[model samples]
Target: MNNKKIMIYGAYGYTGELIAREAVARGLRPILAGRNSKKLQPLAEELGLPAMAVELGASETLERTLRDMDVVIHCAGPFSTTAEPMMRACIEAGTHYQDITGEMEVYRSAHAMHKEARDAGVVLCPGTGFDVIPTDCLAAALHKAIPTATHLTLGFDSDSGLSPGTAKTSIESLGVGGAIRRQGKIEIVGHGELTRTIDFGRGDKFAVAIPWGDVATAYYSTEIPNIEVYIPMSPRRAKKMQRMNRFRWLLGKPWVQNWLKGKVDQKVRGPSEEKRSEQKTWVWGEIRNDRRGERRIGRVVTANGYDVTVHGSLAVAEFLLDYGGDGGYFTPSKLCGYELVEKLPGSGSIKVGID
Candidate 1:
């Protein structure tokens, strides 16, 4: 029992439930946890695991529940709000912590906790999700393939849809515009500031600069001087979307956000069981070493984005179980080396294309 104990915070949410399901199937007993007991109880029973109620805002209550746990998989959404408090509780209780957070600001905050975690001898890993894991790991792999690489550009085309929580958070970030790293400094750019079209087999798809967590991860992972991450949007439509986002500042009112959320929730039907079963994501990355007069490009395709995220969360859990006690807050790239990248699940559901 002691060896099987793992807590799945936010277990009732879309991604959290998936993680709980995956954990149970792997013979790990997950302690289903979240703010609402009534919501988590049935899930725990359905999965045949114990359930505990936890609220991030209530630090004392959170700490008490986290005690004696071998590890915790935080699947809460919009991590900007939930990660910090939960991390504090984990450090206080000496429990190893991992989260699927992709928010750059949230990652910075978690990274700041490294010293405290190290002193306490507890592991803290953030961005163990689709947001940065595959990208970060793949970036590391590319850097190794071309040792002199100095810049990287990553893009992807995902047939999978976004979950409600993910959509909500994305809409919130719309007004903030996209961010990129140029010459080793973080730069914020307005929507459509930089646009290009890249062929992804299906056709030439348009992409725009987006404030993805990769900007933060890639800098720490590889010695690339410039890094930019983009998400595909149809060229014609991309322009329209940019226009809308540029004016998002006017809609900053809470009521406008609520309205947008409702509209988005209705339009973005998260990947259905059928969709998840069929959806795939293809990612491309290019590393250029101008000094060496060489460039290496790599590509990877995987099952549904959410599933990849679950896999990453599990990877973190496994890492923690094996070697996390040394402590310190760390990103995936910082914790594991090239070998870790190679060991990740890369079966038929995931394929890597490199050149």
Candidate 2:
């Protein structure tokens, strides 16, 4: 009975289910929504929350649903495909759109709608989860520390694995190589083309550049002309990732994607409660302007990605409700402020220092 008409689309997925349970714990009754009622209704019934089932392919159904929602915490993915329609529907209905997407493509595309969202008086923000929240905030904090920063590098290593939806996104992108921002433009490069030693506040780890969402969001948050983000990968895995470039065509096919999805569905159920409690997620970022001879560094530690997603998603929804801001396209840092990462329920600590 929170009286906030928030809807959790894809609420039956792994992270979505977690968000729904935690939303109830926090006294917000979110509608359990997704593409299937057979799956959604049970969880909705168990949680005593209302439920809705609608296909994104059905424009009328999607539009009708959007008209009823005040805000949507879109848990569906790979959002690269689902987002455009949903975003348009939300804008048309004047409903705030928030999603847990970390896809660099999604962020770039969403950023293009700043004016429309502002005109519609609705907030359109994605990367509400670990995908870029910690790193994006770190980038913003470092930017605030050194406004002249011309280059930014962000990285993270988490003691956890992907959920099914996350794994599917990863599989889809396996053929897409990697990307980095250079002079404010996104540049695509070979997979594992860039590797560096990063100190994620814990210790040194070999991290390789991947198409993380921060590559897009950090640029907007900091106005930095160059940005790259990484995650720890062992030598063998790095080599395997590089090898994937030669087979991009095969890996990107729909049937092959489905086959890999089958593998992921079999193996990835995400971490359990005990594992989530035991895990630690770390993010590191550096801001530098060689011409100005300045350097700033920031690091953060947080809970498992999924846990942070649960808390971060709801936290954002709460912010839109309480902060009462004019709507526009926003990065996590822009919408919630740089302290959002540190203020998040499960995010551990943040440290910024001059280097």
Candidate 3:
């Protein structure tokens, strides 16, 4: 049993509620927190867990609220707006912080605070969910299988619908070009700059490169010098993404971005529980050393992305609580070795081999 308390910030959010339920089922007592007491209080009551209503900008109050918590699972959206303040509060409170962010910007922010986190004896880990869990694990596994790996290509295909938070993040990044790591350096390219046909055991599906979180975390996880992350995109959407570069300025404009955000808000709020249960996610990863003329490929068939996110995030919080580790920045694979994938619901070892 953990003596320290766990806090789930943004506990009223969709993913947060899922994580909170999972934590409860696992016999964990998590404090649900958000900006709304009405929403938070009910959830806390329903789950028989503590609840706190605190605004992020209220630094002093927020820090005080966080002070007693051993770890915080931040589930807020876009992360760009929420991560920094929450992270600062966690640091000041000397609390470990984890989040389900897939944004490269957030990963960089958490990474930049590694030294500070270590000094404060606080673990600052982000991307504990669908963003990089399976991919990071795959990257680590491939690197283990081929220690000399220098290049990585990861492709993900999911039938799950996007959460409102995820949709918001995607909207904010619509104008940004794709990103990749080249020779240990970060580089940006047009959306369709790189495309590949990935065979994830089902059939060939064309994938377009995108600025995925793995482009940031996989580098640290596997030390691979070159990496490209892809998600399957319909040809129409692929063309649209490519055209975004030409109208980058337009898309980046506040009015346009806000209008797009409004449209997303009007859409449905992610998939239903039934859909989440019925759908699965397919992930493909490859590691290669062109110099050695060797390649290894791995595929993961896991529960839908959102389901994995909830399980992945809670599992991370539990692990950190059970076995306190040296405080520092870490990715999923970095915090819990590649085998963490096997422990995740609906995820097991894949048959990886040379191709």
Candidate 4:
């Protein structure tokens, strides 16, 4: 049994609560934390673990709170705003940091802090969960099979609907349109600017390119100079997204963001336990070196996105507590082996074919 003090911040949030409960069920007791003591305390009490209320904005207090903790599983988001400050504080406190963030910007920011985290001996990794873990693993596996790969593509088809946090992130992403890695540089494009037919092991489906974390992460992991990430979409919905690109400017308005956030609070309860049980997510990856006439394709089917997030987040957090590492920024595949998927309880299987 590990004795390290593990803390899950935003412990009462939908995804956070599930992770906290799962931690307990696995015979681990983690300190729960968030901005509200009232919300954090009851959950802590029920789970028989310690609790603390510390605002992420409170730098000094946040540093102090993290100073003694061995690992912190940051389950809060719209991470674009929250991840930076927490990452800074963890580096200051010498605490290892892990967060379930899908935001490519967050991953880039963490990677940029590699030197600081390394000097401070803090292991900083983002997208430990559904955000990029499964896909990142697949990318690494494809790269392994086709070592000279120059172009990598990843896509997913999930029936796992959004939680408030994910919905908000999607709204933010929509406003910014799409992103891809071109010749090792990250580039932004219009919403739904790229689309292709992809066989994600089920059959050919129209997939539209989106700004997924792997556009940044897979390139970093495999040094594949060109990369794009996509999600299966109905042709009608794909066209709708393309149409929405015209008004992308409106989505960034403070008033518009506020209204959308309010609606999420009122309507998005995330998936219930039974609902999560029934849902599944599929991740697909393809890598090729056109110059070498080599190509590889792979896919993985996993539990509902949210449930997989909880399990992946826990697995990485526990791994950090037990395995000492030279601190630095890491993708899931970079830190944990690509076979990390094999360790995920209900994450199903990864299948690959080469040509």
Number of the top candidate by TM-score?
A: 4
**What TM-score quantifies how close candidate 3 is to the native fold?**
0.96
Candidate 3 residue-wise lDDT at 284: 88
**Alpha carbon lDDT of each predicted model:** 0.78, 0.87, 0.87, 0.89
Candidate 4 C-alpha lDDT tens digits along 235-289: 9998898898898899878789888888999998887899888888888988889
lDDT of 3 by residue, 136-203 (tens): 88888888888988899988888788888888788777677779999999898987778878886568
Q: Determine which window of 10 residues in candidate 4 has minimal summed lDDT.
A: 346-355
Question: Residue 4 lDDT in model 1?
Answer: 44
Q: lDDT tens digits, residues 117-230, model 1? A: 999898888888777777787788788877777788887788877777777777777777778888988887877677777654356777887788888878877868799987
Predict model 3's lDDT versus the native: 0.87
Sorting all predicted structures by TM-score, with the top scorer first, yields: 4, 2, 3, 1
Model 1, clash count?
0
In model 4, how large is the Cα lDDT of residue 147? Answer: 90
**Is 1 or 3 the stronger prediction by lDDT?**
3
What's the distance in Å from true for residue 38, model 1? 1.1
**All candidates: CA RMSD (Å):** 2.5, 1.4, 1.4, 1.2
Candidate 1 displacement at residue 312 in angstroms: 2.1
The segments of candidate 4 whose C-alpha lies over 4 angstroms from its true place after superposition are none
**Candidate 1 collision pairs:** none
With candidate 1 superimposed using the best TM-score fit, by how many Å does residue 153's alpha carbon deviate from the native? 0.6
